[model samples]
Target: MRRTLGRMLADSRTQPAHAPGASNDPLILREARADDMPAVLDIYNAEVRTSTSTYQYAERTLDEQLALLSSKQTAGDPFVLAELADGSVGGYATYGPFRPREGWRFTVEHSVYLREDCRGKGIARPLMRHIMGHAKARGFHSMVGVVDASNAASIRMHQAMGFQVAGVMREGGYKFDRWLDCAFLQALL
Candidate 1:
């Protein structure tokens, strides 16, 4: 069974005031609202334009991002946003079906992103923990992260979170006029 956003938000409030990647500032990890789409889109589009985090070369519009968020909500998938003390939408994490086949129902692929300035501030760790908790609560048996092999920070972060490197696919993606290798990491819930 899927959990409601309200329930998830309420549950987050009951957790420790400061988890990893959190500091003196009040950090909130909760379901995203419609008004949050612009900030979310900005972060995503920045990645699309400048990073190999996503293979999408074209930037996504606000409507498209909003639609995707809506789809996640409709499917009861976890899509969480991280709010900094100043109320800025600094990052987000989400999970979706790893594959469409029925046998893959117990597995999900997850992703996390943070604003450029928000990195190294102890935000992603707690945000990712919230995502993992949600996935586990929703009965997922495994969570996978497909990260770029060259992205040391992300790789190390996943490793710190107990995700084991499952395998690597050389030249698995194309971006920036080159082929990029992808490393897959998995954590059993």
Candidate 2:
């Protein structure tokens, strides 16, 4: 089943380009490579320090990010990125196992991040669409996103993609010296 699904995705055509005026920036989404780690770390660290998108406390080193990327690649998991024409990493999105339990093997959780300046430009929508399509074709039964309750934009975006709120865990995370709520949204692939 996995081999057949992989073959189908490999033969599938690329998604259509963003419509005119969708985004002023010329962005292309593709699988992230080792060379993209530095740029990916920059965007990820920025979000860590300023946004509740991730509950991580400290910035990750380039080596650490590369190791994570390498693990994903080795596991055949997707680590995708959106790049600007100038080769800067505009954003990245990826998924991994939702739980360690064997029963959850077909469920995955994903996250997406865009550089601060890249927000409000519709970059995330197409990025997510691409990821979801890939996940479905790859036989993932469900896709989940754990979003901070304070992040309205991300919550709305997930909803627009047909994800529904599965649950909300109040004060589930402590970050930046405060308790944070996490909302889980899930979509059946």
lDDT per residue for candidate 2 within 1-189, as digits (tens), equals 234323322322232221112334467889999988988998999999998999999899988999999999987788889887787878989988999999999999998999999987777877787777778778888889998877777876776666766766879999988998887878777
Q: Residue 93 deviation, candidate 1, in Å?
A: 0.5
Q: Show where candidate 2 strays beyond 4 Å.
A: 1-26
Give each model's whole-structure lDDT: 0.81, 0.79
lDDT of 1 by residue, 114-152 (tens): 999998887788877887878888998998989887776
lDDT of 1 at 33: 84
What lDDT score is found at residue 59 in candidate 2? 92
> In order, what is each prediction's RMSD in angstroms?
10.1, 10.3
Which candidate should be chosen as best, given lDDT against the real structure?
1
Error of 2 at 183 (Å): 0.3
Give the per-residue Cα lDDT of candidate 2 at 13: 24
